[model samples]
Target: MTTTVNQVMTSYYDAYNSEDPDRLAAVLDDSVILRSAAGTGQGLPGYLDTYRTMITTFVDRMTPQRIEADGDTATVSIVNTLTARADVPDFMGMKLKAGETLTLNLRGRYKVRDGRISEIDIELA
Candidate 1:
């Protein structure tokens, strides 16, 4: 059976919060593209690299405030809370020291193909 867009997005967020690169990659297409203020990444390898960096640098948690899906597309409003694991001199224009926490309100537009996420465009909410 084919997965619905909502199911794909739910799996994506669950994988992200799990902080397992392998789990997150499972929900992504091989050629997935992710665009955000931090940077843009293409392909599974690039995406995994970004995920590793973020998890290593901070304790990150993504909480979905709203999720709306139609056909193969999904739009999600999220609250991302990050507690620095190490001093980050600059992160998306913010500086954080170890033990410090920062929260961001974000919106993400996702495109799903087959049962995987193909593209994600993220921005500040």
Candidate 2:
């Protein structure tokens, strides 16, 4: 059986929590798009690369708090807490801590097609 949108979202979050790029890729369409407060990506591979970098270099974990769907669209509410590993610029480009836990509220919208995520719109809370 094919995966449902909810299952895809759950798997995506699980992949994220696992910090595994290959796992993250499994739930996304090849042409998946990600739009967020941090800009956007055109494909799943690029998104996976970004996630891999974030997980390896900056973030420690990202957890989904809730999920809801309306037709083919679904929203995943998540809480991401990151532990800085290097001196990285903040959202405004200001240099920040090398090791600090930063909590961010996130909401991501998934557009599903053929049981895969085709588009994702994300925002910071």
Candidate 3:
């Protein structure tokens, strides 16, 4: 059986929300590229490093408001909430004290191939 684009995206979100790096990695192609406000990352190692940094610095959650897929491409509108685990003087140009929460509306474009995510581009909505 083949995984649909929706399924791949669902798995990605689930893995992200669960804060499980291994599971997240499982759904991503080794050569995946990620572009977001933080920066661009190529390959699994780069992605993992970014993931670890964010996860360690804050408690993050993504709520998808809408998802649309065509062929192997998908776009998702999401409401992301991040609570500072500790004081952050500078985080993507934002400062937060411990327990402070930041919410952002974002759009994520994804390309999946062979049941894994090959590329992702995230931008402010």
TM-score to true structure, per model: 0.96, 0.87, 0.97
Per-residue lDDT over 1-125 for candidate 1, one digit per residue giving the tens place of the 0 to 100 score: 88899888888889999999999999999999999987788999998999899999999898889999988899999999999998999998889999999999999999999899999999999
Question: What is each predicted model's overall lDDT from 0 to 1?
Answer: 0.93, 0.81, 0.93
Sorting all predicted structures by TM-score, with the top scorer first, yields 3, 1, 2
Comparing 2 and 3 on lDDT, the stronger one: 3
For model 1, where is the 10-residue window of minimal lDDT? 1-10
Put down candidate 3 lDDT per residue, 1-125, tens digits, no spaces: 99999999889999998888998999999999999987788999899888888899899899888999999999999999999999999987989999999999999999999999999999999
Best by TM-score: 3
TM-score of 1: 0.96
Q: In candidate 2, what are the lDDT values of residues 21-55, reduced to their tens digit?
A: 78778888899998977788989778887787787
